[model samples]
Target chain A: MELQKKIEILSAAAKYDVSCSSSGSSRKNKPGGVGNGHLSGICHSWSEDGRCISLLKILLTNDCIYNCAYCVNRSTNDIPRTALTPDEVADLTINFYRRNYIEGLFLSSAVYKTPDYTMELILGVIKKLREEYRFNGYIHVKAIPGADMKLISAAGAYADRMSVNIELPSSQGLRLLAPQKNKESIIKPMGLIRSGIQAKREERKLFRGAGSFVPAGQSTQLIVGATPDHDLNILKLSEGLYHRFNLKRVYYSAYVPVTTGPNLPAIVKPPLLREHRLYQADWLLRFYGFKADELLNDAHSDFDTELDPKSDWALRNLHLFPVEINRVDYSLLLRIPGVGVRSAQKIVAARRIGPLSYDNLKKMGIVLKRARYFITCQGKYYGEKSMNEHIVRYGLISGKPEIQDSTPQWEQISIFPLLPQLPPPEVRLATLTGEL
Target chain B: MIYLYDGSFEGLLTAIFEAYYRKENPEKILRNKALQQTLFEEYIHIPTDEIKADKVYDSIRSKISHQALQHAYYTYLSDFEDAGTWIYRYLQLGWKMGHKVDYHLADDRVLTVHNTSRKVFGESHLLLGLVRFKKLSSDLFYAPIEPAHNIVSLIAPHFSSRLADQNWIIHDVKRNMAALYNKVEWVITELDANPNLTVDEEEQAYQGLWKQYFESIAIRSRVNPDLQKRHMPRRYWKYLTEKQML
Candidate 1:
C-alpha cells in the first residue's frame, strides 16, 4: 500500500484515542541532534473538531486481535488495515519535525500478531528516531496492555511519555464489550511505569547525567459515555490514578459510537458537552483543591450541563458566597466563579498594594459578571440585594437578572434601539432541566 | 511634533532617547515610511544613534527587571497604532517605579503596554506552532510566515535552539525580512528575491501524507470549524500544509 493510504488508515484508527498533547518534557537538543522539546507543548494545528493537534498521532497498525465494542478498529469491523514499517515511522517523524509540522510523535498500535510483537515494532521506530536519526524531540508511546514489562521499559528509555488506555472506567464495562482485555492488563503496566520512573529519578539524583525513564511521565485515556459510568466514578478513579501512579494527565475521550452492538449504549452523538463538563470538574480536582465528593457524589452522579462546575458548586453552596474581594484567601478566591488561577494570584499581589475595588478586579482579569454575585468589594455588594439561589442561577445561565430593571427616563433613549427583552421559555426550561 | 526614525528596534530606542534628551513630548512617534504630513503638527527627523540607543538600553536594563524589558521589547514589536506613545508612557512609569511597574496593571498606560505586548507574545508563540517548513532543493529548510505582529526576531531564538543542527530560514513575507540561521548563528536579512525556490521532489509526497493524516484524524461526529479557527486562525491557513487544497 502507498504511504499516504497507510497514514490515512492508521491516523483515523488512532484518532479515537484522543490523547493529543505532546507536552510535559523539556528535553533540549544535543549538539548534533535535530530537535528539542519544550515544557509547554506546542500545538501544530487544530483539528476540525477543535481538538489541539500537537503530535504526529498515529498507530503502527490498525490490525488488532481483540474486538473492543466502542473502538473503530475492532477486529470485526472489516476496515482496510495497514501498518507502517519502523523506518517509515522514523522517517516521517524526523522529516515532520524538521519541517516544523509537529512537536513530536505520539505513536500507538493495536495488538498486531501479538502484544510483544506490536511493542517491538513501536520500540524499533522510537529507537531509530532517537539513536539513528538523532532526533531528541518529545515522543509519547503507548504501553500496550499485557505486553512484556521488559519491552515496555526498553521503550520508556527513548519515549518522553507513555500511556496504557484504561479503555473503560470499570472492569464490568470492560468485560461486556472488550472481553479479551482486563483491568489488570492495563493498570499493572501503569504501576510498573510509576515505579520505573521513581527508580530513575532516584538514580538521577545520585548519579549525574543518568538516563531518564519516561521523563515526561505517563498518562491514560478513559472512554466516557460508553457505559453508564457516573461522573463521580470517573473523577474518583482519576483522583486515585493521580495519587497512585503519579500520572501526568487523565484524558477523557467521549465515546463516539462506530458500530452496532447489543452491549454498548447507542449514543447517536459523542457526549462532548458532558465531556467538556467532566474536564472542567477534572481541572477543579487537579488544580483547585476540590475533592471528588465536593464536586459530585452518589446523589449527584453527573454534572450540571447548564452551568460550569465551578459556578454550579458556588450556587449549590450559597452560604459560601459574598467572599470579600479584599479579605478572601487565595483558595476561596480561586473558588469564586470568575477568578482563574492567574487572576487569583494577581488579586493576591495587587491587593497587597491597596484594597481593590470592583473596577480593579475586572481590570485584573476577573469575570465580574459571574463573580459579582459571589464576591463583594469592601463589604459592599454590586449584585442584587435579595440574592436567592434561583435568582443567582437565572443570572448565571441566562445572563439576565430576575429582578425588574427600572431605567431612568434620561438614559432610556440611545442611538441603539431599546427593546424589552424577555428570557425565552425554552432557554429557561433548559436551564431548569440542567441540560444544554 | 512627530518624530520619525528608521523602522528598526535601535531606531525606536534612539527616538526614545531623543524624546528624553530634548524633553519634548512629541505628539506621535512613527517610522519614516509611516509618517503622515499634517498641516498643524511639525515633523522632526531623528537619526539612528547606536550610542544614544545603547545608553537608554543600559539604563532600562539596570533600572527595570528583565521581565519588564521584555514587555517593552514585545510592545515595540507589536507595531500597534499609538504603540510608541504607549511604550513611552510605560517606560516613564518604569523609570519611576522600577520593577514594581509591571504590577501596576491598574495604570491605563501600563495596561495598554502589557496587553499589546501580550498580543505580540501570543502571536510569536502561535507562529512557533503554525510555522510549516518545506525542504528546499539546496537542503535549506524554508518557512514563510505572515504574522500580524513583527515577531520574526522574537520567534528566531526558538527556531535556532530547536533546529540548531540544520540550516533554516524563517521568512516573514509581510515584513519583507527573513531570519537566516546557519546552525551556529542567525541574522535577519531582507528577502525580496524568491530565486525560484523549489521543494524537494519527495516533499510533496510527505505533505500529501500530512494533509491526509490531518483530514482523517478529525472525528466526523464532532466537526466544528469555528473552534478550529479560534485556535488556528483562518488568516494563518494559507501557509499551513494541512489546510491547503489538494
Candidate 2:
C-alpha cells in the first residue's frame, strides 16, 4: 500500500482510542537532538471534532487477533489490514516534527499476531526515532496487554507516556462485549508500569544519571455508554485508578458505534455530553478535591443533563451555601459552583489586599451568575432568590438561555433552541423520554 | 505633557527614565510615529539612552521583583496603542506598593498591564505549536506566520533548542521580520514579505500526507466545526497545511 493510504487507514482506526494529550513531560533535547518536550504541551491543530491534534496519533497496524464488539478494528471486520515498517514510522515522526506539524508520535496497535510481537514492533519504532533520528519530542506508546514484563519495561525507557485501554468500565462489561480479553490482562500491565515508575523515582534520587522510565507516567481509557455501566461506576473506577495505580489521567471516550452487535447499545449519537460531564467530575476529583461519592451515588447514577457536576453537587448540599467570601477557606472557595481554580486563586490573592465586593469578584474573573447563589460578600447575600433548593434550581436552569445566546447562531438553532427555552412540562417530558 | 520616543523597547524605557529624572508627570507616552500633535500641549522627544534604560530596569528588578520586570517586558512587547501608558502607570504603582502591586487585581492600571502581558505570553505559546515549516531547496526549513502580537522573537529561543540540529527561519510576514536559526544560535532580522524561495521536492508530499492524516483522524459522529474554529481560529487557517484545503 502507498504511504498516504497506510496513514489514512491507521490514523482513522487509531482515532477511537481518544488519548491525545502531549503534556506531563519536559524531556530536554540533547546536544544534537531535534526536539524537546514542553511541560504544558502544545497542540499543533484542532481536528473537525474539535479535538486537539497534539501528537502523530496512528496505529502501527489495524490487524487484530482479538474480536472486541465495540471496536472498529475487530478481527471479524473486513477492513484494510496494513502495518508500517519501523523505518516508515520513524521517518514520518522526524519529518513531521521538523516541520513543526506535531509534538511527537503516539504509536498504538492492535494485537497483530501476538501481544509480544505487536509490542516489539512498537518498541522498534520508538528506538529508531530516539536513537537514529535523535528525536527528543514527546512519545506516548501503548503497553500491549499480556506482553512480557521485560518488553513493556524496555518500551517505557523510550516512551514518555504509556497507556493500556481498560476497554470497558467493568469486568462484566468486558466479559459481555469483549470475550477474549479479561480485566487481569489490563490491570497487570498498569501495576507493572506503576512499580517501574516508582523504582525509577528511587533510582533517580540516588543516581542523577539514571534512565527515565515513563517520565510522563501512564494513563488509561474507558469506553463510555457502550455497555450498561452507570456514571457512578465509571467515576469510582477512575477514582480507584488514580489512587491505586498513581496514574496520570483516565480518559473517558464516549463510545462511538463503529460496529453493531447484540451486546452493544444502539445509539444515534455518541454520548458526548455524558463524556464531558465525566471530565468535569474528573477535574473536580483531581484539582478540586471532590470524591466520586460526592458527585454521584446510588441515588443519582447519572449526571443531570442541564446542570454541570459542580452545580449539581452545590444544589444537593445547600447547607454549605452563602459562605462568606472574605473569610472562606481556599478549599471551600473551590467548592463554590462557579469559582474555578484560577478564580479561587485570584480571590485568595486579591482578598489579601483588602475586602472584595461583588464588583471586585467580577473583575477577578469569577462567574458571578452561579457564584452569587452560593456566596456572601461582606455579610451580604447576592443571590436573587432566597436560599431554597427549589428556587436555586429554578434560577440555575433558567440561566441557561443567556449562556446559549453567546453561542453561535447556527449551533443554537440546530442543537438547543427549544431545550432551554421550553416550559417546565415539555422539558420534564423530554427529560423523561431521554430526548435531552 | 506628552513624551515621544522611538518605538524600540529601550526607547520606551528611556522615556520613562526621563519622566522620573526630570520630575515631570507626562500626560501620555507614545512612540514618535504614533504621536498626534494637539495645540498648546507640551511634547518632549526623548532620545534612547542605554544607561538610563538599564538604571530603570535594575531598579524595577531590585525594588519590585523579577516577575514584575517580566510583566513590564511582556507588556511592552504587546504593541498595543495604550501599552506604553499602562506600563508607565503600572511601574509607578509598583514603585510605591513594591511587589504587592501585582496582587492588586482590582486596580485598573495593574490589571491592564498584567492582562496584556498574559496575552502576549499566551500568543507566543500558541505560536510554538502553530508554526509550520516547509523544507527549502537549500536544506533550511522555512515558516511564515502573521501573529496577532509581536511574538516572533519570543518564540524563537524555543525553536532554537527544539530543532537544534537543523537550520530554520521563522518569518513573521505581518511584521516583515524573521528569526534565522543556524543550528547553534538564532537572531531576529528584517526579511522581505516575499522571499521567492522554492520548496524541496519532498515538502509537498509530506504536506499531502499530513493533510490526509488530519482528515482521517476526526470522528465522523462528532464533527463540531465551531469547536475546531474556536481552538484553531480562522485567521490562523491560512498558514496551516491541514486547513489549506478548507
Among the numbered candidates, top DockQ falls to 2
Residue A291's lDDT in candidate 1: 86
Candidate 1 stretches with Cα past 4 Å from truth are: A403-436, B193-195
Candidate 2 residue B93 Cα shift, in angstroms, is 0.3
Q: True contacts preserved, each candidate?
A: 0.79, 0.94
- In order, the Cα lDDT scores of the candidates are 0.89, 0.92
Q: What is the alpha-carbon lDDT of model 1 when measured against the actual structure?
A: 0.89
**DockQ of predicted candidate 1:** 0.67
Look at candidate 1 and give me any clashing residue pairs. Answer: none
Using alpha carbons, what is the TM-score of model 1? 0.93
**TM-score of every prediction relative to native:** 0.93, 0.94
A114-186, model 2: which lDDT tens digit per residue? 9999999899999989998888999999999999989999999999999999979998999998889999999
Clashing pairs in 2: none
